[model samples]
Target: MSRVVWGACLLVASTAFVACADSGQTAAVARLASGEVAVSGTPEGIPAHAPARFEFGTEASATRVAMWDIDVRPDGEGLPPGSGSVAQGREVYNVYCVACHGPTGMEGPNDRLVDSEQWDDVPSTRTVGNYWPHATTLYDYIRKAMPQLTPGILSDDQVYAVIAYILWMNEIVPEDTVLDAETLPAVVMPARDKFVVDDRVGGTGPVR
Candidate 1:
């Protein structure tokens, strides 16, 4: 049985190698736009290369590195210190967001940030309130890539405020709610229980 499995593995490996080589080869009748015959496959054998151990680029400063390391996790980890209220968010929305996202977050030329009362409407939209599992995701995404044209310009307070407004519009949070790193993660989204973690490895085994 072991020998059988080993033979099968070798056969599979050889077949895969052949497939890769075949894929690299161009069709026999293929021609370039300039009316020249195209090279079929890459030249055989690996070419001379640079030293693998050679290092490039200066060591980056911690402060400069921190700017790019702004991804907030699902658990609200990496949230910067800041707070914003629903009222403040509404004002921010009107000023900076209304152009692309429309009056409310729902009337959008872009993706709607507000939740729909009914999901069965003729023009259905997937919103952050009803679809997103984590509130931190909102804070993270908005802070990283909002305002459309000029991304990463909003302060932490503004990001929090806009998140608050969107959450309020969805009815996920009360209009008077204040959002910060501490409270943002605590506001469990409606779809939180719907998502399941997939840990599968091999098809016939238990979740890894």
Candidate 2:
């Protein structure tokens, strides 16, 4: 064949080969300009080793869900029916909290929980009395995760008592004060006014 004829034949053969190679493969997913995802594929497109149906464990039971849904709001929404006095709290703290939070919640091997002094914006100096904006949050946090070594082990009354002791140490409540669902949320935090609402909509201006 002539050189020109031979080159044309080679180009045609290459184009045909590419078309044949691409015929077996299909685009599984694609994104359109309008930000919508387009999917196109058959079961045959999946690998043979893939399972016919996936078993992602059993569905969670209502009782199991209720166990983990123990979040308490600032308004005492989820506070359980229990009470704790400062004296009772002291006992609970001595047994479970003293090791981590120190004897008086000041000499901590961990974060200090009882400082009524002014916070100098230093993170290390921030404590429950000086920095925390909500007293209920303290109860919520401790009940959810506390004692460091064994979290969620304290009973509701014990949790309340321990919180009372810490608050007493912080001078937020009187030594004889008893905290329960009604009284706990009513306890005002000292730093409550320090925090403001972040009303910035969408990714607008600087973070509040």
Candidate 3:
């Protein structure tokens, strides 16, 4: 072949190789003019404008995805789109909580403490209905932490339903009412008025 033709052939091969290089380095979150992002683990000849997608190194990173599995306080900010009935709460309890808090909300040997007749006298010192001052506090605590291994797995409604179920078990409220921010804080507990604040120096503590 002629020298000129040979040179042209070599140039074409080089260009083809560059175009077919590994495609592993680009973030796949932002939208470029193309409307879609390309990601790769290796970038042998990828353009600089492209996003990165490497595994161990920052050469390529992924777009952040929101995590919604955290427990939320009863304030309503983190509440999921759900509402649970006392019956529904019972279901949740049976599946996730009853094992720990006992079958009938009583203080079983290793189960969670509750307001059953067995612990009526002992529970007034710490049970949900006998000790907790605000029903919202129960919701908040349970919403953020409960069911042992899987915390914050239940939706807001489920949390409320569970709270209501537990409360009903303690004879604090009916088993049909819904639990929410508005209704939660006001559902007075037997120990509601007995709670005193850290008022050793600051007058009589936070105003009611």
Candidate 4:
């Protein structure tokens, strides 16, 4: 064959091969709009049967799962079916809270937020009896999230029991009383009316 004809034949074959290769590529594989290689079916390497959504799966199990994690709120929401007395609370306090909060509920290693003394110059002054506006905050902070190292470990009954004990020690409630949502909210902490509204904006200003 002539050299020119041979070169032309080779060029035609290469062009045809390139065209065939280009035709095989996917059209919507990687679109300009999405910037994703949109998968019409199951994505590469992912099994079709696998969950694309969250599921432990099935209706009965789903209800159980939801019920398992029901949240109890601060206003007597997740209060378990239990009751506690100041007597019981004293026992709980001795075991769980006393070392740091003290048996008398005074400030110990931790900030005593129950019945701590009032001093005009004393910094870090807050006790459950003297400072907390609502006793439910004590139950909520303790039960939902205390002990400094561990929180939310106490049962509802135990938390109420401890709170009752703290109140007794603080002198707001009698030693024989039981604490619950109804009674706790009504206890009327000494500082409840004493605390003035704070409306301040910056550094080293007068407190109202």
- lDDT per residue as tens, model 2, 29-123: 11121225535444656786877657769988878877777887666766899899999999999999898889989998998888888654554
The per-model lDDT (C-alpha) reads: 0.75, 0.78, 0.61, 0.65
What C-alpha lDDT, on a 0 to 100 scale, does residue 136 get in candidate 2?
90
Candidate 4: Cα lDDT at 76: 42
**Model 4 poorest ten-residue lDDT run:** 25-34
Judged by lDDT against the true structure, how good is candidate 2? 0.78
lDDT of 3 by residue, 1-208 (tens): 2578556655654453343332221222112212354564557787777666446544322232125334343233334555666788888888987766678877554544465333433443466756766566666577667766898787778887888888888887786777665666557677654543222333566663
The list of candidate 4 runs beyond 4 A from truth reads 1-80, 113-124, 201-208
CA RMSD per model (angstroms): 15.5, 21.9, 22.2, 25.5
Model 1: pairs clashing at backbone N, Cα or C within 3 Å: none
Better of 1 and 4 by lDDT: 1
- State the TM-score for model 4: 0.55
Winner on lDDT (1 vs 2): 2
**Tens-digit per-residue lDDT, 21-90, candidate 4:** 4544233321322235445787778687877865765656656755564343324444456667899988
**Candidate 3 vs. true structure, TM-score:** 0.53
Misplaced by over 4 Å in model 3 are 1-81, 110-112, 116-124, 199-208
| lDDT head-to-head 2 vs 3, winner | 2
Model 1 regions lying over 4 Å from their true place: 1-55, 116-124, 197-208
